[model samples]
Target: MIPTNIVVHQHSKVLELSYDGGAIYKLPFELLRVLSPSAEVQGHGPGQETLQTGKRDVVISSLEPVGHYALKPTFSDGHDSGLYSWDFLYFVCENQEQLWKEHLDKLALAGLDRDAPMTTKGHSCGSH
Candidate 1:
């Protein structure tokens, strides 16, 4: 699955992925950060997802291609272990709204701020 075009908008902090069928997806850096496919975020098994917070202002520092099927994005926050496969990226694009809403819900449940550190003076996600 070759994306016809992949453009990273540094100014807008978004990644635009366009497929041959004319579907285009605009994904924000913060969204990508929170939904990273790395084990650090996804954990090794189900029910072990680590909630990602304090990424409201995160930006993509660079996007590196992995052979022929994935992208490795390095974020400004220093996270770079996730290898975004073509299928995974497409999935994110197709289910962006729902995924984003769920992320927000989880944050609310944990009382975490998207823009503030979890360990900030008064901010907490109720996670130890």
Candidate 2:
């Protein structure tokens, strides 16, 4: 289900997707950044997922279409690896509430705060 229209609201920090049925979904920039499907965020496998912090003010610097199947967004933080497919975007639109809750839970469990800055001390690879 490809979106009929896609708009990036810089001031509000949301990516709005409108479908054929007039259903519109607004995904926050922070949500998109934290939930990015790239290896840097999702990691190579399941448990290796990295917890994204200090992304509350993250913004989409640019958006590029990917072969008519997905969108690649360059975030203000310089992250641009995630390719958001139509299906994945739809799923995200539908499950944003639950996803946000889960993210908050993870942050709490990790003794971290949503607005905290990302630390490089534990990331020995220096990939981030």
Model 2 per-residue lDDT at 115: 98
* Model 2 ranges with Cα > 4 A deviation: 121-128
Please list the C-alpha lDDT of all candidates, in the order they appear. Answer: 0.88, 0.94
Error of 2 at 35 (Å): 0.3
**What is the TM-score of candidate 1?**
0.88
What is the lDDT for 29 in model 1? 90
C-alpha lDDT of residue 90 in model 1: 90
- TM-score (all chains, Cα) for each model: 0.88, 0.94
Superposed Cα deviation of residue 89, candidate 2 (Å): 0.6
Question: Which candidate tops TM-score?
Answer: 2
**lDDT score of residue 120 within candidate 2:** 62
RMSD to true structure for each model, in Å: 4.6, 2.2
